[model samples]
Target: MASSKPKPDPLSIQRGDYARTLAGPLLLGLGRMVSIPLQHWLLTAHPLSHFGIPRPPSDGVLELPLVGAQPQLSTIFLGMTATLILKQNAWIWGYCAERITVPFAFFGVVVPAMYECLSALVFSYASSNPLWRKEFLYVGAAVHFFAAAVELGSELARARFKGRIENRGRLYKGGAWGLVRHPNYAANVVYGAAYGFAAGGPVYALFTGAFYWSNLTGNATPAKENYLAERYPEEWEQYKKDVPWKMFLGIF
Candidate 1:
């Protein structure tokens, strides 16, 4: 009989694993950088305007009254907002890549991004409108602050969500998470609403808010809870008892 092929060395396999461990994070960083220009163009430039839609009057300038008075400030804020969006997009993409299962995973990744992209596109047009009142800028600023608060709250929840350490996972039940089981989704709700507020119209508000709500209630929240339930059955039971609502306070 032919001699059996030599067994692969376990140490070699371990070394390969070690070498490839940083690949995910590295690619994530590179992808974020590479995507910046495209995202900027999509959000600010209104590339689809050539297809019968109106574009911003000029590049990188919001056509709104005082906002257009100082183009640089508006541009800086726009860039910052877009950067935050890209960062969040990368984070959720990573989450879906790692945690989501098939048959539903594709939907999970695409839906949330579409909601955000729609909001951004609407805001681009809304900001480009010269008809907005000066006071509405204050409204936009206030909503921007609210969105920032949601972001900060979600960050705090992430700090508390120390997951699967040494294969012994611990459920987060303090801070923002204490108020709602899905603080992250709540943040996304606030974010979506803020975008609507910034856009400043009844139609945009309804569309953006509905899309955001559907993403959380109809998509992300259920998928997240399902995974949480499977990953930490006992802890998830207790968590539900302690925090009844999935995305809202006193109501879901």
Candidate 2:
């Protein structure tokens, strides 16, 4: 009889897996670098106006005013003025304190702070009036605001979630976790793609996705699973049974 085929190793990294590990980050980074500037460059180089679009800087400088180089400006605030109602634990300090460095945490605090400021700068610089007719300051702000809120609320609930903990810092229940096991990660994918969309040009659309992908591999992957699994054994396994992966809203 022919020898039994060698069994694939469960822990071994496959060729495709390694390629994906490299490709995701590389593509995302390259996409951002290539698109954003290309859009800006396209806006600035023209002398004659196209389709009634306003003109950009004649000197060919991309101010990146979103970075706060503009004068007499302010921010756009979209926040949880209303307290997020959620279950808390005496031992967990309300879930917000534990994962202080999470992306959703930074997004909550940062996006609103910069939204109006960036929009104001983009318009002030003009670079040839709105690249797309569908673009608007309110729309972009709303998108970022919504995504940030979802991410933040979900993350907070996750921190205090009671369930499996492959690690001391991880879990499998609570908040958005009850719906989608990878709520934070799902939010990242949404907002990452939306950032380029909000930028309102093909350039950002092409590149920003790569950044999110890279970010997921580096930050969201093990932090959400393997790390916790190693720390907490029985709880995590049970949590996995209680919730499904990527179900952010609900499961029927």
Candidate 3:
């Protein structure tokens, strides 16, 4: 019988290869920049109005004064952009993984770009509705900002813990980790839904929330748990007992 290869220790994975770290964020930023102009055109110019695209109300809440060539920004737009900027910086600086794989990076870029573009489209489509409230936009923006802060803070806490020499090979169980096994994942869902809500409304918010919840729970969270189990067999089991929740407390 042939000998099986030994599984590499998870702790051996290095952090932050410049090329891999930078590539994902740069690509994401490019995609976002492109989406901005597209969003502006969709909202203002209504270039696709002939193709069943309903024109936004000339005096709609979405219609703000233009600043030079660009449409005047809204709270929703600012929240979305700020979230992306925060995430990009986190990936470049705070993420502990050394090499972000090409497929994952591409997935990250494509998913967010699609979400942003589609959300804008949906929002524009719904703008003519008399029931659509501007307060939803402002409230969603606040939630988005709060979610971003939580995500960043939790990730930074973990990163700082991992950076300590004495903490090498040890599991992080403090800060937000004490609250849930995956606070960052929880925050991801919040911000994603918040962005959707701010961009469109309840329908978009539910869509985004469901998408993120499913993705994280079905894929990302399980994969991470398995990795942690392998890396810290005894500690992983204990941590699960201690935390009791995977991502959201009293929910998952």
Number of the candidate with higher TM-score, 1 or 2: 1
Error of 3 at 97 (Å): 3.0
Residue 209 of candidate 3: its Cα lDDT?
89
* Model 3, span 1-252: residue lDDT tens: 999956533322323233445665465545545666666656676655666756643333344356433232343564476566557656555564565544555666666667776777766765564545567776778898888888888888888898899999899999999989999999989988887777667877889889889988887787678778878999999999999998888998
Highest TM-score against the true fold, candidate: 3
Q: Please report, as a residue range, the 10-residue window in candidate 3 with the lowest summed lDDT.
A: 9-18
**lDDT (10s digit) by residue, model 2, range 174-234:** 5677766677667666665555454444455345555666667565565557645755778
Highest lDDT among the candidates is held by which one?
3
Position 110, candidate 3: lDDT: 68
For model 3, the superposed segments whose C-alpha errors exceed 4 Å read: 1-33, 51-75
Model 3 residue pairs with clashes: 16-98
Tell me the tens digit of each residue's lDDT in model 1 across 113-180. 45445544655565455554334434655665666667665664464355447433676777778888
In lDDT terms, how accurate is model 2? 0.44
Q: Where is model 1 poorest over a 10-residue stretch in terms of lDDT?
A: 10-19
Model 3 error, position 137 (Å): 0.5
**Runs off by more than 4 Å, candidate 2:** 1-126, 129-131, 134-137, 159-172, 246-252
